[model samples]
Target chain A: MALEQGDELPELSVTPDKYLTVRYAGASGDYNPIHIDEEFAKAVGLPSRILHGLYGMALVARAATEAGGGPASLARLGVQFRGMGLPEQEITVSGTVADAGEAVTTVHLEARQGENAIIREGVAELRR
Target chain B: MALSTDAVGTSYPPVLYAVGREKVREYALAVGETDPLHLDHEAARAAGYADLVAPPMFTVVYSAPAIGPALFDPVVGIDFARMVHGGQAFSWGPLVVAGDEVTTTVTVKSIEEKKGLGFFVFESVSANQEGHTVCVGTWTNIVRGL
Candidate 1:
């Protein structure tokens, strides 16, 4: 794929299962109760046990890598958690090539759950 | 309790982590990454990586320990119960391959109290055994008042 500004990268969508949250907690060593305990999440005023923001960020990073060519191609990524991600909902990761230079390609990324944008102000730079 | 801005600029000693192929693969699986470069050693090598390539976000797995001291510091007065992950950012250097022993040094980048909320920022740098930087991560957390 020839890199160019405004080109949409391939979209990556994932539905995070309830069980996957537990697995991610164990794998990432981020055992925050809000991510694994539904009751705790409610007590904290959340709708439910929300997925870890990094989990969603990781998916976005993967999309960037896939778009840029490989894992080694990713050089920078940034995301701000705007909304909560509930388990079992489909989250879509998409991006557009913001800049295509000879040495790198910058991508403006976004992750959405249906109509709500869970991650905003997302950006990634990939080595060309 | 308000987080003390006085704790800003505190730095923690480096923590060592041994990067394993299985650990990387497990994280990739948990994140729903199906790329062969993250799971298969042969595929990784074919793709020009030394071994199974870790996802860029995989740095969080190894570097989380480095930020523990600041997050739990008694002086900081961070209420774990009220805290939530606010955001994350990353800058990568060389690719982290399996068998690389990395050390992460964490520092408290900033702390602020505003509008009945506390904001904390932590910066962590992970370097390989050869002293080459693997990644730099910035983690931000927001703590709400009870």
Candidate 2:
């Protein structure tokens, strides 16, 4: 779909499997213990291993690309980490086109896990 | 101890990344991406890309290594134990195709402490082998109870 003002990006709802952080760590080379080791995370005062914030942002990027029609259409992505995201819960990325210009369209994105907002003030620019 | 404000503007030598096809596939799978444009070479070619497409966030892989030096640099003095990923933003130029060699350079954009919290930001520029800018990334980290 050609995104225009007030268009909604395809909603992406993903539930991270138990090994998601482990797989993401290997693929992204971000082997931080807080994302992979449950024991280490609990030791550091977290409930358990937390999802990588980047993973959540990536989903936002994917949603924009999906709505923009292709990967090449995405020109920029910005996301803010507002709360911790745990595995096994539904994380949803949803957004609406805020401005549609001749050259670019701006999509305002937000991500959430239940009541917690994982990414707030998210934005994406797509070539129009 | 507080972060070293002087660390701002410290630049690191550029690092090069060979954008491998399989690695791109791994990342797409890890993120549970469904677009054939990113996963299937033929689909990407069908849609005008030269090869498998690298997701926009793939910039992280090329830029993370450079962030390491900035994170560990004594001049920056980040307390890793207390630091947490705060946010990320990227301005992309072109779609990164598999086999495109990308070079990333990072610099400490800012280090500031406010109300017992420390904020660190790094700016990175990634360019393709032909010297065209591929992406610019900004990474933010926050230290608690600083």
Report lDDT per candidate. Answer: 0.89, 0.90
lDDT by residue (tens digit), candidate 2, B42-141 = 9989988889999989888877887788889988888888888888899999779998999989999998888889999999999999999999999899
- Predicted model with the maximum lDDT: 2
Model 1 chain B: worst 10 consecutive residues (lDDT sum): B1-10
Runs of candidate 2 with Cα error greater than 4 angstroms are none
Whole-model lDDT for model 2 versus the true structure?
0.90
- Over the stretch A79-100, how does candidate 1's per-residue lDDT look in tens digits? 9998888899999998998899
Considering summed lDDT, which 10 consecutive residues are worst modelled in model 1 chain A?
Answer: A65-74
What's model 2's lDDT at B118?
94
